[model samples]
Target chain A: MDPLLYDILVALGLGLLGAVLFSAIGLISGTDETTTIAPVTLLVVLLGAPPAGVFTFWMCAAISKHMTHAVPTALLGIPGDTMALPLLQQASALRNLGAPHIALRKMLAGSVISAFIAVPLAVLFAVILAPFGTYITASAPWLFIAASVLIAYFSAGRWASVIALVPFTLLIVALQSFTGAHEVKLGVSYFLGIAIGPLVAELISAASPLERKRMNRSEPRETTLAPDVKGWGGYFPNPFRVLDRSQVRATATAAAITSGTFVFSPVAMTVIAGEIVGARIKHAYHRLTSVLAVRNGVTESTYIAEALIPLIAFGLPLSPVAAGPAAPLFNAPPRFTVNSETGVVNNLHTLMSVSEFLIWGLVSVVIATLIAYPFAMNHARSAAAFVAKRISHEAIIATFVGLILVIGLWEGGVIALLVILTVGLVGGLLYRVLGMNTGVQFMGYYAAVLSVPAILKLLG
Target chain B: MNNPTPAPASGPDGQLAEIWGDVVSRPQLGKAILIGAVVSLAVYAVALATIAPLASTPAIGKALAMLAGIIGCILGGAICARLFQPKRRVVEQIAPGAIWQTEVLDQIAIEGGAIGSVEDLPPAVAQEMREVGLYSVFQDYEQDRARNREAG
Candidate 1:
């Protein structure tokens, strides 16, 4: 068989595998994305999968996970992941309105519409931005600071996020300095710390009487599951038709706009886009549904944009989404390593070209849509019911904990574990109390390495 | 699960302009953000002196930096939490009646056919729709028609 033919088969098969696996995992409500995505992605890299296989698996996983992740957000009144945070307002609001089934349909429809649009648009933008790669990389330190401020300003905390970046950066810089001395260079630790910040905070709070008292509710929280609405004919009804004229328009417009902003935080874009749309719609109910659809669309578009743009154009992790969730594509040790000490680049940027990225990116999206999208539509009710009723938080948390420990041991022994715990607890506390989200923290991590040194040099 | 079908893209995009018009704007997460910023910066500036020495250290500077970071975040989070007041839950305010009204609205919105006005719906539905700022379709019917004509 031709090598190209073999590669195609491998890519397609792996794409489906990734989609199926993550879709089920995503349906497990409250499952954090980084915990689920990072470990498996690292495994693919360490397993020495081919570039096509790795790319296919990763893109498919991200696209599919996000697609199905909306299930719990829309149905169970819980956010599916970090990106799904903005959707919660609408989800909960719509659920309050007794139409979680409608919210789920709208979300799934938006996922299908926006995801299909994001791929080609991301590829196009990446190609356009490719020529500026050199200048962008050269000014990365300054750009990181600017991006830090921009993203921070747009976060839920607004300007407070901007100010919070100072401490977060200082924390990261301090940790990196101390850990670097021990000869235990760490990367995944901080990512894991920020990703699991809330859980770590909750665990710590449980130990304190005052904190535990604050969290205590005498009455158990009740979530009334709305019965699935009966309308709509056929399996996998046309995604476009599921939404109204305004919804389809909002989805398309937001998807297009967000796909171009590869450098901004996905959550920020989702909020801004939804806000922009929300400001225009008069009906509170319609605004909730439309914004939910639009914001969900933004999630898919922003991820696709961030990954494709940086990988194709600069080959450097320029965006938060690129640096965090999509980090494996840029650097995963043995097979792919963007050397921090030497500035040597040997990841997807050095491994593949524009044409290959476009080809494989689209292939991953196509395969993912075929599997995740339809699966989400047809079985959303059953899936949501099962996850809400049965999925154990302990089992999920335990698995993540085990993975974090395993990765910590693999990279730097006990020190790495300490690094992750310290970062996670403090970071989680800051995250919970300060209103600073993980996306902003992820940017702060980048600014520490990329911007802080430059600021110091300028000061000196 | 039933097998999926093709999703044909809809056209006549211009009439949907009314959907984007702002009847509702999202509430900002205000004072918490300001309080968070003030508290964080104060901690960083004060703690920088203690952590500055570690910055000069060779490989270990990174680890020591994190130690200082942890200190700053805790202090900042403490101050911010004290200042930031939590909002009461409004989800509880959504009476069961509102839920039924919303379901009917969703059905109407999906059907995309002409309805005389919010008044044409049941009295409970009309009142709920009124609360959400929804009203008669006829109010903007002429504008949509014009936009649709232009879009076509």
Candidate 2:
């Protein structure tokens, strides 16, 4: 047996015990407060902790982090982070029906299920594909530019909007270039982003005399009954439910095209890959669940694949989303680096070895799920009733907005707040004024990087 | 007239429904793209222009500039494009009506039940009603399943 695996198992067992303790505290406190956990966990791991031991510790932290994030989004209307934004949006609906606990469990279950599937898969994929990782990493910048431009050009309004992308991109380049070293440039960018982001929507909100109109919206179906575990289990989307013989056969016919492309942008390809999988699965019975599960798998795979590719090939760590949490745990440096001159590619074999340690993250999820699932299911009624009775709707919104403010400022600074708002406004305006999708607008921004230079060269 | 209390159910639905329009605007997108492209070029230009002053090996400067240029171009093209694209708000929706109320649906319903039973419909359908709907969730699931089975 590899010494590493043995050490990892020992650490993992200890970490599981820690996770149980944290989960219990969270259940009682109704909070997974992160202010201290992040630093404290790091202290423990960095102070002579084994790599595998760090993995176990981090895993426990991550699962609890996910579980606790549910509290604000589910109960207080606050999303823990940008990644959780969508989850919160979905969960909020359940919260409205006064069934926040159910919403929380669903999201927790989904995340836990996905984590179990993704974390190890990420490590394995990273280890196996280490050889080709470099070529893909080197090629990423162009892919990013192409995707950006294509998305921008294809947005609702075609020519005019596409043309508009040029100046927009140039302005950004000019500003970023001009303010090369100043702290304030970021502030300026943020201001521009926030101010412009919601411009159209805010305008419409103001201009639409219809704003005064009132109507009674349908109420949510409030349920206090215990959720069916089977139904809940069914809710776990099967990632591979879509590969019927016919669709698989059809896809096999196109294997050349499928294999030809290499994915660099995990976030971008996640949807594209998911759709392709869903389409192939169309011939199967139980299309919806199958479609959903497969999509989940693709999304997880994309994240795992994209994240590991950079790590293995260029020794560059790119998964800020997952790494943001994991990095602190490993006492690992924030960024992954690969220098060409050093010819450090050989060293990758050593780093790929670290993935053996991540099995702990998978283990943590299983153990955390076992501990959390019961609290979520059994105590949901009281949890829901307690939240409903104790926290006022106004309080929830205030807390949520307040959290957004703090988080926004923390991430982008006061300037970022402005930028986000600007992006939101501009995004809203493009949709309203030009009838373009935000995706296209963002695409154009990326496209302009290529097009603007091409145009400048042509005119030059 | 007493104003009807905005039911929690209707609130999230309204939020989800309205995501498309609220998310994208041309001016904002145009600016973001412009910024990304220009920055990429500038990085290259700066790297190239300063090659002469770089001490020791001049070739090193040239190589560094070229590398930076390439990376900048790629990032400007790919990441920036993605960041600035116009998308339907609902495309960003995390889950179904069971998860959150459709903000868009509430607005439509408020205008007079023009679209009813937003809840009864599949989360996918409600997602589609919003302009940003990707419609690829199920499709991706299928692809993943195939990959997994093949791997297994």
Best by lDDT: 1
Compute DockQ for each candidate against the true complex. 0.03, 0.04
Candidate fnat values, all: 0.02, 0.03
Model 2 RMSD vs true structure? 16.7
Q: Write the per-residue lDDT of candidate 2 for residues B1-152, one digit (tens) a residue.
A: 77686534323223111211122232333444354446555666676687535735654454455455545544554454344332221111223442233343343235332332333444544343232232333244335546889999
Candidate 1 lDDT, tens digit per residue, B1-152?
Answer: 77475232122211111000001001111232333344444444444446545565532343343334434434444443343222212132233563454455445456442334433344543443444334433234434545889999
User: Candidate 1's residue-wise lDDT over A78-144, tens digit each?
Assistant: 6777788888867875666566766777887887789889888888998888888878777777876
Model 2 global lDDT (CA atoms, 0 to 1): 0.41
Model 2's TM-score against the true structure: 0.42
Backbone clashes (count) for model 1: 29
